[model samples]
Target: MKAIVLAACLVCMSNGAEYVVVVSKKSSFGALSVSQIRDVFLQKRRSLGEQKTIPVNVLGHDEVRAAFESRVLGMDRNRLNAYWVKQHFQGVTPPLTQPSFESVKAFVENVEGAIGYLPGSMVDAKVKAVYEF
Candidate 1:
């Protein structure tokens, strides 16, 4: 498990990008605890305080996605897949997905209350990072 995590970190570092959870600059949603983030991502918590929150994900198995899953979600891909499968049966769908970091940033920027993760280097004035991993 440690080896896998190390590898994931190394992969991100090798690409010269650190990952962070971000929200629109206009969003009032502040920083979040890991458990809070977990709940939001899992669809256990629908909103951040009074504001409706939308969690966005990067499509496919990108390295940044893998790192976020391992470090923040604390679940392997297979386990997460199974969990989502069960969620599907219950009619709880996974978060919306964007094709790449650029699209994720765009979505979060344009959509109010939207949140997502991306490489730290990609963050700009349009988005505010709520958490770092």
Candidate 2:
């Protein structure tokens, strides 16, 4: 049992697949706690660290996006689809879904009140990691 647990942890750690959620280095939000992050993602909180929040999503299907959904939002693709489907017509959509991390970063950097995540290697000094999952 211990070995299995260790293996699972190792699997999660290998490459440390996830870094932290980041925004442009110019952002005022340097870091965030999990609950604070959850609030922003869920649209429950209007701001973080003196800046309004805009949470963006990765489009349709991407492996890293999948990780963000499951690992971060605690929701599966099906649930996510259902969620968007429900939000689509309400004139509300789940963030502006982007095709890649680059786009997300661009959006965040260009716009205030924006937040998104990319892989660790993709993150540079331009963006500051707000939270590490």
The most accurate candidate by TM-score is 1
Clashes of 2: 1
* Best prediction by lDDT: 1
Q: Candidate 1's residue-wise lDDT over 1-133, tens digit each?
A: 9999999988877765478999999999888988888888989888988989899999999999999999999999999999999999999999999998999999999998898999888988999989988
- The residue-level lDDT of candidate 1 at 2 comes to 100
Clash numbers, per candidate: 0, 1
What lDDT does the true structure give each of the candidates?
0.91, 0.76
Q: Predicted candidate 2: what Cα RMSD to the true structure? A: 5.8
Q: What is the TM-score of each candidate against the true structure?
A: 0.86, 0.76
Model 2 regions more than 4 Å off: 1-17, 87-92
For candidate 2, lDDT tens digit of each residue in 1-133? 9999999988766756365688777777766877777667766577875678889876778878777777777889899778768767776556666888789888877887788878777777777887766
RMSD of each: 7.1, 5.8
